[model samples]
Target: MTNVQGMIETCVQCGECVEVCPFYKATGNPSYGAMAKVGAARSLFAGEGLTEEGLKTLWLCTRCDRCVSTCPVGISVPDIVQSARAELRRRGQWPQKCSNIANAIIEHGSPMAAPPQDRITYLGKDHNVREKAEYLYVPGCWASVRLPEVARASFQLLTKAGLDITTLGEKERCCGLFLIDNGLMDEARELAEKNTLLLESTSAKTVITECPGCYDVYKRVYPALFREPNYEVIYIADILKDIVEHGNIEVKHSGRKVIYKDPCPLARRYDMTKAAREVLGHVAEVVEFEEHGAEAVCCGAPAGVKPLYPEVANELAGKLLKEASSKGVDQVGVGCPFCMHHMSGVQNGTEGPLRIRTPSQLMLESLASER
Candidate 1:
């Protein structure tokens, strides 16, 4: 159990959290505010526990952590809410959507529910994945099953750059960020341990992922849950950026004006805005959305919100897309496959007002042009 007393003391209630929280900003509900969430959890901790209504309210958070950045005292309201969710799950009061995800992962090894044997099919065709290589690429569940293009492009770029990389294929499992967000820490820990062991089994010194959620788990959560990872975990954006800047790979300039939507975890959590933009500059004219970097809005995918409250998720994604539409860019480039999936779903058509593309996809376009 996290120390609610310390979290409660950290909030100054200055309305800074409310200002940036997706639920509060979209619905204008003070009860959905981040500070209010902390207060609610504090009350529950002091008393018996939260009611069903209180549990739902706690799950409303997108877990963007914007409030943590804005709080005068640096209170992590999302973490508090996550802790409350754990308590709710223990009492069987958690959301069914999140519970389903946890169950799916535990039962099926991946949240997408595909058989483990089919995992290698996500690679499209089996390329020679060396067992002992410098890079071990783990395409999180979303990219592996839902959006394989991003994974394929990332793999192609890595291969083209002449770096020796290996993949676990079906051996890879969920990084368990979904479980962690829903307060299923034990389940998350189990997955994390499995992933750590799998990565350690390889001679690769670095682990790469296209999913921001998986990267966050490997970079932040796993270290705390287990021992510090002996291997380095990297976002594909940073990997591609280095490949471009160091002259290992060259891409013909597309000259297309594109707005980049910074995935909340990548932009705010990992401080990866610069690397993403630096890579974008190599292929396209990088245009800024109305909100970029730490101030950027959520696309409605974080903290299991996309599956739990899709209406709310789509509403938030619509707002993000609207900002990009207003800019009149040719395409919207995103680093996170989760963000790209939601954004693509919200777009009007295959060739809508703006195309939603992975950063690696955009780079591949230019790289292909050069070829």
Candidate 2:
């Protein structure tokens, strides 16, 4: 029922997409390439049935939309892949890893299956939290569970900037990004409704998040899937940009040359290319990746790829880090916590001298020096 065939027909098979597809570049497999995935989507829509390898091909995509950007006919391979994934989900053919993630989100409110009570431990006991505030900070699952330091740094920076921010704490839920990415639309919708109500209950005028997945879902996907959110959704980078430009807090330069990697959802999908750079430029000498902004490469961890195909994900991350090291930067800065998590994981395994830090973390370091 999805116009998969119509979309497939529009493709000229120009292979421009091959140049940008990280999955294909990492694997060197035609099936994992964007064009082949488009054909697979057409087959799935035509009811040709799913094969084991065919399903794997569909799941390999991070849905970064690099192919869509390069398409001569403007055919969106990510759109076709999403349709195919929805079809697979309808047939109960989703990968077990995806199902497990969905279950964890459903039962535990986190993809990592972390306990809800432990969610706020990262914030510590002595902190500024109110029942209602002007801005609600949703750190998403990654920052709250996996990357507590990033969450704390983000909170410290915002509070230092004198913003009236509060968090959902134990009541926070996964933005259902994994479910949405895996085509479990019904589950994603349920979480969207629940989170919308929970966030609206706070009477907050603005919703700020450090997670690109949460920002994208709340700002863009939620409205299309359900209704426009009652509060405005903003990325923390934008807020940090404001704070830095207005001199809300005293910051000293670190004299560290760093490459800032742009998150695909924030940079490509939302055109939010400047905020993170503006913030980073104030504290460190910000360097650009070979392909920066809309053309920047993905960190290769989103949309279930990190859990399902970690080798490929690591490969992509390694490539980025190698390039950064060659550029002679002291560190690689990212706006998205997941990018930091993935790239740092890879950096830890290697002897590379590069360090990974978010703009918030870097600014926090600068602020600490002043004390």
Best candidate per TM-score, number? 2
TM-score of 2: 0.96
Native-to-model Cα distance after best TM-score fit, residue 118 in candidate 2, in Å:
2.7
Task: Give me the overall lDDT of model 2.
Answer: 0.85
lDDT of 2 by residue, 1-371 (tens): 34666788787777888768888778888777888787777678777976766777788888887777788787888878877887887788777888888899998888889988667867988864578999999888888888889999989888888988899888898999888877778888888889999999888999999899899999888888889977999899899888888889878898889899998988889888998898889889989889889988888888888988899999999999999988989889888888888999998899998888888899999889878
Q: Give residue 183's error in model 1 in angstroms.
A: 1.9
Q: Write the per-residue lDDT of candidate 1 for residues 209-280, one digit (tens) a residue.
A: 888888888989998887788799999999998999899988888988889888888778767788878888
lDDT of 1 at 349: 40
Give the winner by lDDT: 2
- Candidate 1 residues lying further than 4 Å off, grouped into runs, are 48-53, 348-351
